[model samples]
Target: MVYDTVVIGLGPAGSTVLYHLAGRGFRVVGIDMARFPRYKSCGGCISVKVGELLDFDISHLIEHTVYGATFTYRCARMMDIISDEVVGYNIMRDRFDHHLLEQARKRGAEVVEGLRVVDVVEKKGYVEVECDEGRTFKGSFLVGADGASGITGRKVFGMDRRRSAVSVTAEVPYRSEDLGMEIDGRLFIDFGSVPYGYGWIFPKERYLSVGIAGDTLKVGGRIKDFFNTLVRGHTLLKGLRIGERVGWTVPTFYGEMPLPVKGRIALVGDTGHLVDPFLGEGIYYAIKTASMASSVIGDAIESGTPDLSTYGEMLKGEIYPEFTSAERLSDLVYNHPRLWYRMIEKEPEIMYRFYDVIRGKESFGVFYRWIWSKVRSKPWKVLRRWLESRFLPA
Candidate 1:
């Protein structure tokens, strides 16, 4: 059967595309290898900006409403850098993903699960997707949301697999009274704890999502050590036994890479490397990119064309510039994490202002420039700290 749009992967990106396209009266269908409520490896923190983009309410799934974060430097010298306003919302990825797919289904989108897409090819005017078990799907346009290690990114778009972040995460179940409201509405962020990345402890109703992430090639075989240190050294995580863990790669944005659109296909979310470079933020970008991809798809469908040439242009103007700026910030923050942490500790206001960036009130470029201006004003001190960071033991 032919569909107006075939969405590959039923996670946030794919389900969002299915929801938008089907709501527009298009015949849309989403396919995924896993069944509903399947586990996903993510920090599971959705920024406040996400609410503005979605038409429906996700409050029912929210386990916590984060007002700020509790920052630490190598699991020591903890400081609370909070905001009077909301920063993000935390939800388990399984429940969050299941809820989104159900919403898409409610919008008249069909879903097919437990079949992995092995290959995709453009034929005549429609794109053909060949799945395991001899199943097949045809659609006028295809949206690939299959994630970082999926065939859509590697086989189809030829995204560079070498340039991404690796992470190890575990959700340790705990009672609400165990945290004593210390982690309530606040994230636990530890800097200078990993190579080119950081550690995070996101609070949910039932568990504490603990994880450590770093550049895949940079961290290499040492990712396990970093994860172990984070889970053990964290004061809040003390006495909690970590059990099963999952590791995955996050495809961050790279400037010189090719656009994620080819012929009748467009890639979204992790498959497109739309994740933030500095903060590893993805959920907001996933849904936003889906909204953009769906709009462009609608336009192409209305014009009786399946080509997605304009989707690349749309990303260039809207999302690419912000990612470029975030990449620049990432260079400073990740490369010299110790110094960056010290700067934040000395001037907590710097982090308070960054919360604005997280809140979407300030652009990344603006915040980056502000940091540079502060550094330039006191070059000698900043230079001394930089040199010490280079020489000091991590």
Candidate 2:
């Protein structure tokens, strides 16, 4: 039987697609390899801007409402930047993802769990997805949210399999009383602690989600060393014990980002490499892009033609430009972390303005140009410090 849409991977992107389409009174089926409430290796912090997009109440799942960050350099020379307004929400990925999946199910989407999709093919009028147990599902359109390394994205879409960032993560259990409320509402972000990525400590009710990510090709080999340095040097984690560490592939946007839609199949989230290059943030983009993909999909179903050109247009216009600007900033900051750190330390307003970007009030492209304008005026000052930081020993 053919449904209106077949969604592979019930993560945020997949669930968002399923939720929207099913709410439109279309028959949508979502399939995932894992059962609900499964563990996901991530920092799991949702920016405050996300709440604006979500129509439901996620207050129940929020473990912490973040206000600002404590920035450190190699776990030293700490600088605290606290904001008056809330910045983000922290939650565990398992419960958060399960909540999203259930939202889709309640909206009339059929869910298939613990079944791996072995193959996907687009035929004359529909797409066919074959599972491991010889069961086949057909749909008018296929939404590949299976993730960066998911079979649907790699095999079916023939997408580039190279991950942009390599990361190691662990949930270190701890009681809030031991650390006190000082840790509440503030995130710990450390720079110059790793090669190309930064170390992060996002507090939860009973654990600290700790991790670091860097450009995979550039620093992938030394990620373990970087992670070890972070865990060993961070003051807050001094005497705590760390559990089994897990490695995850973060497929950030890099070289030529092609349009994710083709014929009756369209890719969303990690499958399309829709992550931020600088921050390695995917949760926001996953849900944001999922909306764009689902809108055109809904229109195609109504028109009785799976014409997805509009989806491609939407991505190129709305999403791709932001990633491009972020890639430029990533190169500058990662290449000269010490200079960048010093600059931010001296001028806290720079970081404050960036908070506006995160809050959706300013665009990254605009912010990139704004920061460059500041640096261009004092070329000699920047040159002297940048050279000193580069050639001199830390």
Go through the candidates in order and give the clash count of each: 0, 0
Q: List the residue pairs that clash in candidate 1.
A: none
Compared with the true structure, all predictions reach lDDT values of 0.90, 0.87
> Across residues 1-394, which tens digit of lDDT does each residue of candidate 2 receive?
8999999998999999999999999999999999998888899999888887688878999998888898888888888888888888899999999999999899889999999998999999999999988989999999999887688667765666565788999899997666633786789999887777788999999899999988777885889889988999888887789888999888888757566788999999998888988888899999998888999999999999769999888888888889999998887788778988989999988888887787778888999998888788899999898888777655
lDDT of 1 by residue, 152-251 (tens): 9889988998788899999999986665448767999999888899999998888889999998889977898999988888898877879998888989
Off by over 4 Å in 1: 389-394
TM-score of each: 0.97, 0.97
- How high is the lDDT of residue 321 in model 1? 89
